[model samples]
Target: MTKLIGALDQGTTSTRFVIFDDTGAIVTFHQIEFEQHYPHPGWVEHDPFELLDSCRLCIEHAVNKLIKLGYQVSDIEGIGITNQRETTIAWDKKTGQPLYPAIVWSDVRTQNTVDQLSKKSPKGVDALRSICGLPLTTYFSAIKLRWLLDHVPAVAQAREHDRLVFSTVDSWLIFHLTGGLENDGVFVTDVTNASRTMLMDIHSLSWSNESIRFFGFEGIELPQIKSSSCIYGHIKQGALTGFAIAGCLGDQQAALVGQKCFETGTAKNTYGTGCFMLFNLGDAIPPVLSHNGLLTTVAYQLGKDQRPVYALEGSVAVGGSSINWLRDNMHLISDHHQLNELAASVEDTGGVYFVTAFGGLFAPYWKVDARGTICGLTQYTTRAHLARATLEAACYQSKAVLDAMNKDSGTPLRALNVDGGMSNSDLCMQIQANLLGDGVLVTRPKMRETTALGSAIAAGLALGVWKDLNDLDKVNKEGETVFRSQLSAESTERLYSGWQKAVTRSLDWAEPVDEKLE
Candidate 1:
C-alpha cells in the first residue's frame, strides 16, 4: 500500500476528507454537506452531535473509496483537522453532551452583548484589541462565550459546577475522537485557532488573563495551547484506530499556512463560503492597526524562539454562500456548479452588478446590518447576467481587500497565493488579476482542500512522518497555477468604481439611524 495522509476539513457548511499520497497528490476524496441552523433571525448554530457524525461519515466514505481502488485503510498515515474559527461550544466535561448548540461566527444574536460590553468596559476592549489585534465585536469568541454563560441556563449550571468545558470546534473533535472525557482526550488548540477566541494574547500566544476576566470567565475554562506543527493528541479509537492527530488550526489560518505564504508581504486569499485574504508579517506586530474593517491576526507560532507571525486579514462575508442563497432563496440557479456554467454563458453582466452583502460587509466596511442588493439591473438582464455578476462580486470584494492591504501596509502586494473552491475557476482568477493588476497564483495541490492540507502538514511534521517546517515547505513549493494581470488601467478602475457604488446602495438603510455606518 502506498503511504498516504488523511485530512479532515470540518468547515462551516461541510466536512470533507481527502487522502494525499507521499508524493503530495490526492489519491481519493469524499465530502458530506450538512445543515446550518438559524434558531432565531441573527442566531446561527450547528447541532454538535450531527457535526461529529458528519465528520465521521466524510472520513469513512473517503476511506471506502480508497479501499475500492485497492488502497488499504492502513495506508493512511495521519489525521489533520482544520475547522471554522470563533464558533463557541459548551458541553459537559464528563459526558461530552453539548450544553448548547455551537454558536456559529455569523450569528449576530450577541450584538447587544457586544454593544453593552463596548460601553461598559471600554478600557478592557482597548487592551484586548491592543494585545489581540481584534475589536470587541459580536464576531469574536470572547463575547459569544459570555453570551452563552450568561443567557443559557444549562451552560451557566455546567460552568458553576465546573462541568461545562468550553472549546472551539477543534477541541470538541479532539475530545470526541480520542475517547471524550473518559480518556483525558487532549484539549489543545494551536496558536492560529486560539488567536480568534478574543481570549489569546497575540504577543504571548496564550490565553490572556485580562481578556478572560474581561469576558467574565477564567483561564481554567479554556483549552490548552499547542504549536501548529506538533503531535497535540491521538485518536484512541474508531475506523482509523491508533492514528495520531498531530495537527489543528482555525480554517482560515490553515488556508494561509497551507498556501505556504510565510514571509512579510506574502499573502493568500481563500474563496470559500466567504472570501478572506491573509497577509503574513514576520515576528513583529504592528503597533498601530488600521483595519479598513478587516482583522489583524496571528498567522502562526513555531520553535523555541519562534516569534508569533502576524497577519492582516480581510473578509468579504459571502462568496459560495451567496450563490447558495441565490439558488435556495431566489431560485436563480438549480445548484452552485450551475452558476459557473450560467456565468460563462454571458459575455458580461449586461450592465448588471450584484453586491452580496447578505450577512453584512466585512473587510474595508464592517456594516453589520447591510442587506444584499442587485444594482444596474435593466430589462436585458438574464439569469446569466446575475450569475456573472455574482462571480465578479466575489472577485471585486477580493480586489477591495488587496487595495486596503496596500493602503495599510504601505507595501504593494507581491504574488497572491490563492486556494479554495472558487479558485478552481480560471474565469474568477483572470477577473481577479485584471482588476487587481497583479498575478494571482493557485496551487496544484494533491487535494483541493488546503485547510485539510494545512492540518496534515502540521500533523505529519509533528508525528515525524515529516521532520520539520523545512521538510513540509519542500513539498508545498512544487507546482502552481499563476494568473497574470492583463487589464488596462481605465477599464479595471471603471468596473471597481461601479462595484463601490453598488456596495454603497446595499448599506443598512433599513437599520436604526444611530447604528448606520457613516
Candidate 2:
C-alpha cells in the first residue's frame, strides 16, 4: 500500500485539505472559502466556529475524493497542519468555547495597544526584538491578545476565572481534533507559530518570561511549544480518527520547507493574501536583530532533539489581496483572471504608481500609520493602467523586501523560489523578474500547491515515511518555469524610485487616536 499524508492548510481567506502520496504528488484535495468579517475600519475578524467547520468540511470532502479513487483512509499514515501565524484565538479550557472572534493578523485595531506598550518599553517598539525576534507590532499574536484582554469582557472574564487559553490557529485546530472538552484535547503550538507571537524566546524555543511580563500576560495560559515536525496528537473522532497529527508550521515557513530551501542563503517568497519572503540562516540563531525592519523567525525544527533553523523574513502587508481590492472594492475587474487580462493590455502603468498600504506597510518600513495611496495618475491613465499598477504594486513591495534581505544577509539573493496565488500569473512573474533585474531568477514550480505539500512532507518526516530531508530529493522536482529580467536596470530603478515616492505619500496618513474598548 502506498503511504499517503494529509495536510490541512488553514489560511487567511480559505482552508484546504490535501492528500499527497509518498512521492509528493497530490492525490486528492478540497478547498473552501470562508467569510471574512470586517467589523470596523482597519479591523479584521473570522468566526472561530466557521473556521473549524470549514476545516472539517474540507477534510471530509477530500477523504471522500480519495475513497472514490480506491484509496482507504488507512493508507494515509499521518496528517500535518499549516496555518496563518499570529492570528489569535482565545477559548475556555473548561467548555472549549471561543471567547471572541479570531483576531486576524492583519487587524490594526491594536495600534493603540501597541502604542501604549511601546511607551512602557525603554527601547520602545523594538524592546522585545532581541528576545522574541519580533517587534511589538499589531502584526503579532501577543499584541492581538493584549487587545482582547483589555477590551473584550468575555476574554477578560475567562482570564479571571483561570479558564482562558490563548493560542494561534494551529493549536486551536489541534485541540479540537485531538478531543476538545470531552477528551481533554492536547493544546500545543510549533516553534514557527510560537515565534510569531512575540511571547516566545527564539533562542530557547520556549515561552519567554520577560516577554510574558512585558505584555502583562503572566496569568494567561499559553500552549506548550514543540518541534515543527512531531506527533502533536491524533484525531479522536471523524473520518481521520486515530490518524497521527504529526506536523505543524506557520504558512510561510511551511512554504520554505515545501520549496526545499534547506541550504543557507536559499530563499522563497510566497505571494498569497500577503507576501512573505524568508531567507534561511541555517542552524544558529543570529545574535543581532535586523536593522532593516525585517523579522527574525524560526524556519523549522524537524525533530524534538534537532537544532532549530533560523530565518530573516520580510513581510509585505498586501500582495494578491490588492488584486482582490481592485475586483471587489474598485469594481475594476470581475475576477482575478480579468485583472490579469486587463493588466496585460497595458504596456506599463502609464506613469501611475500604487502604494498598497491598506493595513500599513510591513518589512523594510514598519509604518503602522501608513494608508493606501496612488500617485502619478494622469488623464491618460485608464482602467488597464490601474489594473497593471495593482499587480506592479505587489512586485514592487517584493523587490523592496528582497533588497532588504540582501542588505541584512550581506549576500545578494541570486534566485527566489516563488509560489502562491499571484505566482500563477505569467505577466506578474515577468513583472517581478523585470523588477528583480539581471542575474536574479524567479522560479515557480509546476506544483503550485507547495504550502500543502510542505505540511505533508513534515508529517511524513515524523512518521518515518521519509527518513530525512535528503529523502525528499525527488519530491516535487518534476519541472519548473524560470523567469529572468526582461527590463533594463535603468527602467527598473526608475520604476522603483516612483514606487518609493508613492510610499512616502502614504506614510502617517492616519493620525493616532485613542480607540475605545467597547
Candidate 3:
C-alpha cells in the first residue's frame, strides 16, 4: 500500500482537507468556505457547529476523491490539524454542545475588557508580557474567553457546573474528530496553539497559575498542552477512522514549518486575508521580550521530548483582504485577478499611500483606534492608482514589520519565504521585493498549498515517514522562484516615508466619544 498523509487546514475563512504523497506533492483535497458573521462593527464570529461540519464535509469529499485516484482510505498514515489561533470556543464537556459562537481572533469586541484588565495591572498592558510573551490585547484567546465568560450566561453556567471546556479551534476539532461525547474525546492543545492563549507560560511551556489567577478563570477546564508533532489521540469517527491525530499547529506557525524555516534568522511572510510574518528564533527561549510591536510565540515542538522552537511574529490586520474590500465594497474590480492587472497597468501609485487599518493596526503599532486612511489622493489618481495603492498597502506594512524584526533580533533576514493568496500575484511579490530593497530576497514556491503541506509534514514526522528535519530538505523544494529588489534604496525610502506619514493620519481616528449632554 502506498502511504499518504492527510492535513486538516481550518483557517479563518475556510476549511480544507488535503492528502499529500511522500514527496510532499498534493494528491487530492477539498475546501469549503463558511459564513462569517458580523453582528457589530468590529465583531467577527463563526458558528462552532458550522466549523465542525465543514471539517467533516471536507474530509469525506477529499477522501472520496482520493479513492477515485486509486488510493485506499487505509493508505493514509495519519491526520494533522492546523487552525487559526486565538479563536476561542467554549462548550459543555458532558453534552459536547457549544456554549456560544466561536469568537474569531480578529474580533475587537473586547476593547473595554482590555481597558479593564490594563487598569488592574500596575505595569498596565505590559504586565503579562513578561510571563506570557503577549501583551494584554483583544487579540489573544484569554481576552476573548474573558468576554465570553462575562457576557454569555451559558458559558458562565457551564463553568459553575464544572462542565466547561475552553480551547482554541484545534482542540475543538480534535475533540469532535476523536469522538465528541460518546467516545470521551481527547482534550489537548499543542504548544503553538497554547502559546497564543495568553494563559500559557512561554518559558515553561505549560499553563501558568499566575496568568490564570490574573484572569480569574477559576472553574474551567483548560486543554493539556502537548508538542506539535505528538499523537493526541486516534480518530473515533471519520472517513479515516482509527487514524492517529498526530500533529497540530496554529496556521502561521504551520506556514513557518512549511517554508522550511528551521534555522535562526530565517523568516516567512504569509499574505493571506491578513499578513503574518514569523522570524524563527530556534530552540532557546529569549531572555527578553520584543521591544518592537512583534509577538514572541512558540514556532513548533517536533515531539513531546523535543525542545520547543520560538519565533518573533508581526501581524498586519489587512493584506489580501484589502483587495477584497476594493472588489466588494468599492466595486473597483469584479474579480481579484483584475487587481493585479490593474495595478500593473499603472507605473506606480502616483505618489499615493493607503493605510489599510480597517479593524485597527496590529504589530509595532497596536493601535486599536486606528481606521483606514488613503493619503495623497488627488483628481489625477484613477482606479488603477488605487488598485496599485491597495497592493502597496500590504507590502508597506510587511516592510514595517521586517524592519522591526531586524531591530529586535539585531540580525537582518537575507531572504523571505513567501506564500498564501497574495503571493500568487507576480506583481504583488515584485512590489514586495522593491519595498524590501536590495538587501533581501523574496522567494515563492510553485506548490502554494504550503499550509496544508506543513501540517502533513508534522503528521508524517510523527508517523516516522521521515526520520527528522534533515530528511525534509527536498520535500517542497521544486521549481522555486526568487525575486530580488529592482528599485533603488533612495526611492524605496521615499515611498516608505509616505507610508509612515499616512499611518500617522490614521492613528486615534476611532476614539470613543461621550454622547451625554453637559
Best TM-score goes to which candidate? 2
Clashes of each: 3, 0, 1
Q: Which sequence of candidate numbers ranks them by TM-score, best first? A: 2, 3, 1
Runs off by more than 4 Å, candidate 3: 513-518
Q: In order, what is each prediction's RMSD in angstroms?
A: 3.3, 1.1, 2.3
Name the weakest run of 10 consecutive residues (lDDT summed) in model 1.
Answer: 509-518
True-structure lDDT of candidate 1? 0.78
- Would you list the C-alpha lDDT of every candidate in the order shown? 0.78, 0.92, 0.90
Please report how far candidate 1 places residue 132 from its true position, in Å. 1.0
Question: Top lDDT: which candidate number?
Answer: 2
Q: Which regions of candidate 1 fall more than 4 Å away from where they truly are?
A: 122-127, 285-288, 302-305, 438-447, 473-479, 510-518
Q: What value of lDDT does candidate 3 attain over all alpha carbons? A: 0.90
Report the lDDT tens digits of candidate 2 across residue range 1-518: 67999999999999999999988899999999999998778889999889889999999999999999999888999999999989999988878888899999999988888888999979999989989888888899999998889988999999998999998999999998998879978999999999999999999998999999998887888999999999999899889989999999999999999999999999999999999999998896553468788999999999999999999999999998898888888888999999899999989999999999998999988998999998988999999999999899989999999998888888888999999999999999999999999979999999988998888888999999999999999998888999999899999999899898888999999777455755
Consecutive 10-residue window with the lowest summed lDDT within model 2: 509-518
CA shift at 130, candidate 1, in angstroms?
A: 0.8
What would the per-residue lDDT of candidate 1 be over residues 282-371, giving only the tens digit for each residue? 677553365465677887765334677788898888888888888998898998789889998987898788888766677778777777
TM-score of each: 0.93, 0.98, 0.97
User: What are the runs in model 2 whose C-alpha is more than 4 Å off?
Assistant: none
